[model samples]
Target chain A: MGGHELSVQPDAKLGLHKNWFNKLTSAWASGLGAVTHKELADHLGGKRLLILLGLVAVTGLSAVYVAASTIRESAMEAVETGFVFLLLFSTSGGSLPSFLSFLGFLGPLLGLALGFDSVNGEQTRGTLSRILSQPIHRDSVINGKFLAALCAVSLALVALTLLISGLGIELIGIPPSSEEILRVVCFALLTIVYVAFWLSVSIMFSIVFRQAATSALAGMATWLFFTVFATLLAGLVADAVVPLPSEPTALELMRHQRIEMALSRLSPTTLYYEATSTLLSPHTRALGPISVEQLEGAIPGPLPLSQSLLLIWPDVAGLVAATLLCFAASYVLFMRQEIRAI
Target chain B: MNQGNVVIRTRDLVKRYGSFVAVDRLNLEIYEGETFGLLGPNGAGKTTTILMLLGLTEPSEGSVQVVGLDPTRDPLGVKKVVGYLPDRVGFYEDLTGKENLLYTAALNGIPRKQAEERVNELLERVGLAEVADRKAGGYSRGMLQRLGLADALVKKPRIVILDEPTLGIDPEGVRQMLQFITQLSKEERVTVLLASHLLHQVQQVCDRVGIFVRGKIVALGCVEELSSQLFKDEPYVLEVRAQPTTEELIRNLKGITGVDAVEQAGDTLLLHCMSDARGEVAKVIYQSGTSLLHLAVRGRSLDEIYRRYFLTAEEQTHRRAG
Candidate 1:
C-alpha cells in the first residue's frame, strides 16, 4: 500500500482505508471479528469469487425448492415428519444430491471451480516470473491462493446455509431450536470438507494444465465423469460385456464387485457423502419401517451419534486424506514448474 | 562495499535447450559500483544469460553467483539484493502502477513508510509520477518502461539489472532512462547491469561492456580502457589535400614516421598511423607540400570496433564454407 506514488493523486483520491480516520472508522464499523480483516480482504480478491457466489445462490435456491415442495405434512400428520425425514434421506441426502445434485454434490465442484485458473492466469498476465523473482517464498503464492479460494467457497456455503435456514423459517413458520441449529452447524462443517474435497481436485488440475482454459475444462470434465452416470454406466457396461453364467460364481461376483467399486468409490463426492450420511443419521441401523418381523428378530436400538461417528471415522479419515493428498501433489507440481514470465 | 571486488561472478555459464545451446560457456565478472552493459545482437544469448543469472532458467552447465550467493541454491537470497527489469517487463495488467509497486515492496520486506517515500522518489526520477495510480494496462511502451524502471527501483536494491531498458523508448525517453541510470550508478553507487543489442545504446552511461557473440564474451573491459587498448599504437585514418607518392609523404612529414598504410581519394591521401602518431602526422602534413588544405583524423567508434572485431563465430563459419 505504501510504495504506490501518492503524489500522483492530489491527496484526495487515495482510499479511505489508508487514511487514519478511515482506519478508526473501519475498525468501528467492523467492530470485532474472529477472522482478521486483512484476511477477509484477501478472501474476496480471488478471480472466480463472483462465480462461486453464484454457485451458492444456486445451492440456496435448490434448498428452498426442496424445503418448499417436500412439506406435504397435512396429508399424513401422524407419520409425515418421519416420512419427511425419509424423503429427505432418499432424495436430498442420497447419491443424486451427493453425486450429481447441487448441495452436497456441487460442494466439491465449487472447490475445483475456485482454483482451476490459479497458476495459468498469472502466467498469461506475465506475473509468474516476476512474482517468483521477489523475496517471497514460492510456497506462499500457491498456499495463499488456495487459502483465499477456500475462504471464498466457505463464505458461499455459509451464505447458502443461512439462506436455507431463513427460507425454512419463513415457509415452515418455525425457527429451529438451539439443538437443530447445532445440527445444521455440523452439516455445514461436513459440507466444508466436501468443498475442500473438490477444491483439492481442482487445484491438482490447475497445476497440471498450464493454460487456464485447459485446466478449467479438465476440472469440470473430471468432476462430471466421476460423479455423473459413472456408477450407473458401470453397471450397464458390466452387464453388456460380462455374460451371465449358468450359475452365479466367484468370477461373476468379482466382475460385478470390481465394476461397482471402480465407479462408485472412485469419486470423492460419493465417498464423502456416504460417510456424511452414516455419521449424521441415528436411525440408519433400523429397517425402512420397523414392523413385527423386526420386533421378533429383536433388532437393537439406534446407536448414539458418537458410536455412529466412530463406525464411519475410518471412511471420513480416508476421504479427507485423499483430498489433502491431491492438494499436496499440486503444491509440489507448481513449486517444481518453471515460473517463466511468458 | 569491496570497492573493486566483483558483484557478479559466473564460471563458464552455459544454458542449453536440449541440443541447442542458447548461451554457451560464458565466464564474466561485473565489478561493484560500475554500470556494465551486455552488448549483443539478436539471437545472441543476452536474454538467456540474464535468465540464467537471475535463476529464472536453469543452466545446462557452470555456475552463477550474485553477491556471494548461488542463484540456484539461494534465489530468494539473490533476489533480495537484485532488482531486475525483464527485456519486456510484463507486469500485472489489472493492478495500478502504485499497487504493483507497493505489492512488490511489501514482498521485499520494505516498511510502509520507507516504501512510500522511495516509491515517490523513484516515480519522479523515472518521470512517471503522474500516472502512478493509473492502471498499467493502458500505458504506452515508453511509459511502461519508465514505470517498470520505477518499480525495480522501489526496493532500492544494491544490484539493478535492466534488460533493454530503452528498447521501445523514444529519443527523449531513452535520454531520461540513460541519465537516470547514470545518476543511480554515480549517486547511489548501485551496481547496474544493462543488457541490450545496440552497442551505442548505453555507451555514454556505461563504465564497462561485455560484447557477447555465439554465447561467449568476445570482449570485456572498461569502455575507455578497451578503446584505448584496441587503438593503442593501432591504426587511425587521416585525410590529406591530395594523393601523394612516397617522396611527398616523407618530405611533408613533421618528425613523423611508421605510417603503415596509405590510400588515395580524389584529392586526398588517407594515412593509417598509430594512435599516438596523430599529432605528429597532422603537423608533418601541414608543414610540407601538401599545403594542409584538409586535415581530418577520425578515431574509431565502439560500434565500429564491435562490428569489426567481434564477428559472430557463425559468420566466420559461413564465410569459410562459402
Candidate 2:
C-alpha cells in the first residue's frame, strides 16, 4: 500500500480558489484553530478554559473595580487613567518578561512578542518540519502562525475591553453612546494592530533566534524603545534638529514650537491621546487660541477638529508605517531563513 | 518492495559550513518500500542530507530529486508527500497528546471524523491510549517518541524521514520503535529513510546501509554483502593451550601447505590458514600432541565491522604522518 496523495498542481505553490483551495484553506483553518484553542486552553487551564477564565477574570476585575471605585476617588480615576498607567507600564515592561500586565506595552509589544519565536518554536518542537512534511505550502506555516497569533491577541484584548466596559456600564453610571461604542471597537482593533506590530517583530525575532524566550524578550525590547525610550530620545532629537534664537521673544516662541514638535514625535501614546481627544472631545482643536475671551466678549480664535486630525496625520502615518515595516521585515526573514538550524 | 524504482536520487551532493564540509560530494538512491539506513558518526551530515531531502535547507552544490521533483524547487509539492521526524521533537508540551495528533491530522487536511479515529488508533498503537489526555510536557522521552511516530504516520505519508528516532530510548522503547517502523513498512508499505549514528541498529533493521565517514559515504550495499566482504576473507583461526611444545609445534607446522601466519593471542595460538586447509591445519596441531583448546572462526559483528572501517581510516592518517 503506497501512501495517500493529495491532488496538487505542480506549479501552483500557493493556494488557489479551486476545490484544492477549499481543502487547503480548511486545513489551514483547522490547524490554526487547533493552535489557537491550544493556547487559549493553556491560558485558562481545560476544555473551555478560555471562556471559563475569561469570565472569571472579567467578573472579578469588574466587581473589584466597581467596589473599589465606590470606596476611593483614586479607584474611580483609574478607569480612564488606567489607560495612561497601562501605557506607561507597557513601555516599561515592553522589552522584558513581567509577572503582571507585561509592562503596559502589551499592545505594540504583542505584535512582535506573540510571534518572534513562532517558526523556530515549531521547528525546535519538531512540528514545523513535520507540518511542512504535509502537502501544505511553507507559506502556510507563516500565515497560520500569524493568524493564530492574531486570534490569540484578539481574544485576549477583547476579553479585557468587554470586561472593563461591562463594569463601566453597570456601576460607572455611563452607557457608552453608539458613537462611543464604535470608537471602543476601533480602539480594540487598534490594540490588535499594536499587538500585531509586536507579533510581527516577535516572528522575525523567532526566525533570527531559535529560543522562544530570546525572541519574546527582543520583541519586548523593541516595544519598550518604541513606546517609551523612543519618545524621550525623539524629544531630544527634535530640539536638536530645530534651532532657536537667544533673544527673549523669539526664544519663547521657539521653545514652545520645539516642545510641541518633540512631544508630537516622542510617543504613539501621546499622539493617540491627542487624536482621541479630538475625536472624543468636540471643543478640542489642533492649533490657534490657547486663551479665553476677554470680559468684553470679543471673539476668540481656535482651530477646528478637522485641523487637529490633519495636524496629527503624519504621526499617525509614521507609527502605522513603522509597524508595517517591522511586520514586512519579519515576513521576509521567516520566508528566507532555512527551517533547519541548531 | 521496489514498486516503481528509485523515488529519490542524489548525485555529488555537498553541503559546507564555513570551511567544514558537512556533507561531501556523494551519490545515493532510495527505492520505494525500502527502509534505507544512513549510518554515520556525529556531525557526519546525516541530518544535513535529510534536511535537504525535506527541503528545509538548500544544497550548496549537486542535484537531488524526490519523486521526480527537485526538492528545493518543488518543496511544497514534495512536503505534501513526505513525513519527517527531527531529533528533538518539541511538541506543544502544553497540548495533550491527542490534541497534538489532532492538530497534525488537521494540518494534513485529514477530515475531522477520520482524523479523530486515526488519532485514537495511533495513540493506542503507541501505548499512549491511557494517557492521551495528558499534556505532552509531562510525557517521558519514550512516550514523546511514540507520539512523534504517531504525528509522522497521522498523514500516512509516502516517504518518512526519521532522524535519530531511536536515540534516548530505553531497551523496551527501542524494541517498540523498531517494531512500529517495521509495521509501517509492512502494512502501509511506505518508503522510510532512517538516519542515525546507531550502526548496529541500522544493520538489524535496514536492508541496505550506507556508511558515512567525514561527510562522504565510504561504503554502500546490503549489510550481509558488506559483512561478507570485510570478514569472510580472514575467517579461520588456530588455537592452542599455553605450552612450549604447542608453540614449537605451531612454528614447525607454519611452513606446512596452506598456513598463512601463526601468532599468539593471549593463552591461545592463532593460525591463519585458507578455509580449505582447516583440516590440514588441525591435523598438524594433532601431530604436535599439543592439546588444542578451541579452533573458532572469527565472526564479525556489525560493531566489529564499523570499528574495522573506522580504524582503517585512522591508520591511513597515521601512515601518512609517519
Candidate 3:
C-alpha cells in the first residue's frame, strides 16, 4: 500500500507545477486532436457520407456533362473567349441549370446531413457525459467535430470540382487559363464557406434540440425555407414594399430590384449563388441595380479577376459572418449545457 | 480509516434546478485508498452530487475539492487524476471494444504505444480480452459494462468514481463486478466513490457507506459502526438451530437477561438480543436436553439498517405533522 501511494504521488504533484493557461492549452490541443481524428475517420468511413457524396456527385456530373456538350457545340466561339473552363461551371445546358446552380441548391443538404445530429446523437448514445468527464475542455468536442466535418465537406467539394474540371477539359479540349483556374478555386472556397454557414446552423439546432431526429427536421425545415421559399418570399416582400407602376420611373424600378436582392441575400443560398456567379463569370460587374450613367464609361468586356473578386467580396464576407455567428451560438449553448446522463 | 489522506472533500455543497434542490448542503470527506459507497434510492440526488464532484455540473452553493484541487476552478487538474464511469455507460456501437478504449486513451492524452499497452492491460483485467476485437454493438450488457470499466481506467487515474456500476446486470455478473471493484481498490490503493441504490450489492464492496436520502446524507460510517450506532437498543441478533426442541427450550432461552425477543422461524430460533448470547442460548438448549445443531450470531444487513432508519425518519415526520 505504501509503495502504491508513493508511485501515485509524483503524478499528483506534476499537475501542480504548470500554470492554468499551459494546462488548459495542452488539454485542449490533445482533446481537439483526438476528437477531430476520430470524427474525421468516422465521416470518411461511414455510409452516410458515401450516400450524400453519391447524391451530390451524380447530379453534379450530369449537369457538367450537359454543359460540356453545350460548350462543345460552340467550341470555336468559347475557345476564343479564353474562359471556356469557367463556362463549364456557369453555362445552362437544356433544362438543367449550371453546375454551380446545382451545387448552390444541394450544398446545404450536405452541410445539414453532416451536422444535424452531431451533439444530440452523442447524448442519445450516452457518450456525451463520458466524453465531457475527460480532462479536456467541453468546447473541444463541438469545435473538433465542426472542424472534422468541414474538412470532410471541403475534401468532397474539391474532389468533385476537380473531377468535373477534368471531364470538361476532355470534352472541350481547352485547358483552363491560370486566371480561370484561380477563379474556379475561389468559387470552390466560396461554396465551402456557404456550406459551412449551413453546417453551423445545423450544429446549433443539434445543440438546441435533444432528439437527433428533431434537430434534423429543424435543419431541413430551415433549409427548405431558405432554398425553395426565400426567393419567392423576397419577391413578394419587394412587390409589397415597392409596388411598381406600368410606366414606373427608373428610381422606382431600381428600388424594387434592390429590395428584392437585399431580401434574398438573407438566405445563404442566394449569397452563394451571387458569389459563385461573379467568380465564374467575370463579365458580372455589378450585383445590384446599376444606373445607365454609372455604366456609361465602363467597357462591356469581361472584368479582370481582381475586379470580379472585389465585386463579390461583400457576399463572401456575409457568408463568413453568418457561419461565424452560427458557430458562436452553438459554442455558447454547448458550453453552458448540463452534461448529465440522459 | 480516517488516518488516510483526505482525497475528496466537499463543504456545504448544494445543487439546485430552479426550485428543486438536487443536492442539499452536502458535506463529505473520503479518504485515500478507501472504497466509499454513496448509497441511495432513485431520485436521491446521487447522480447530481457525482456530477458536481466531476465539475460536469456547477453546484448552486459551496465547494468541492478532489485530490487537493477544486474541480470547478481546475477541472482538468482534478480530472487528470480521476476516472469516472457514468450510470448507463455507453460506447460507440460501430467501433470495436479496443477502438472505444483507445479513443478514451487518446482523449486522456496517452501516447499510442503506451495507450495500447494500457488498454490491453485493462481489457485483460476486466476480462474482456476475448471479445476485445468485436464491435461493441453486439456486446452483451455485462460485456459493455466491463468495457466501460476498461474505458474508465484507461487514464490510470488515482481516484475512480463509478455511478451504479451494476445497475442492470445478471446476478452473477453483479457479484463478479463487485468483487472486481473490491480487488481493484485493494491492489491499486485507489480511492473509489461508488454510487448505487442497491444497498446489498454496495455492502459487498464498500469499506464505508453513506446513506443519502432526499439530497442529504442521513448516515455515514462503516457497516459495523452504523449498525451499532443505530441498533443500540438491540445490538445483537443470534440464530439457533436445535433438534428435539421443546416449549421449555424456548422459554429457557427467553429467560436470558439480555435477550430481547425470541421467535421460532421454521427450524431455527431467531433471537433479537442486546448482547452476543450464542453461548448462553446453546447452553440453555443443551440443558433442556435439546440437541444444539447450530448456533450463530447474524450481522445486521444494510437492508435492515436502511429500513429501520427510514421507518424512524418517517415516524418522526409523522409525529411532527400530527
Which is the leading candidate under lDDT?
3
lDDT tens readout by residue for model 3, B68-120: 99989999888889999998888899999999999998898989999999999
Candidate 3 C-alpha lDDT tens digits along A4-107: 87876545456676556676677566698899999999999998888988998999988989999998898888877768899999999999988898898889
- The DockQ leader among the candidates is 3
Model 1, first chain, TM-score of 0.71
Computed on C-alpha atoms, the DockQ of candidate 2 is 0.53
Candidate 3 lDDT at A231 equals 98
Separate DockQ for every predicted complex: 0.25, 0.53, 0.65
Q: Per-residue lDDT of B87-170 in model 2, one digit per residue for the tens?
A: 877678777899988888777667889999999998999889999999898999999998898888888788888989998989
Estimate, for each residue in B1-322, the C-alpha lDDT of model 1 and write its tens digit: 2349888999988887768777878899988999999988877888888777777777889999999988888777888888888767767676678777876777676777988888887777787789888988888889888888877777778999998999878999898889889999999999999998877776887888888887888888867666776777657777666334356675455235767677666566777776546667766765654555666666567786687557545587589879
* Candidate 1, CAPRI quality class derived from DockQ: acceptable
Q: RMSD to the native, candidate 1?
A: 9.9
> In model 3 chain B, which range of ten residues has the least summed lDDT?
B308-317
Q: Against the true structure, what is each candidate's TM-score?
A: 0.78, 0.77, 0.92
Rate residue A54 of model 2 by lDDT: 47
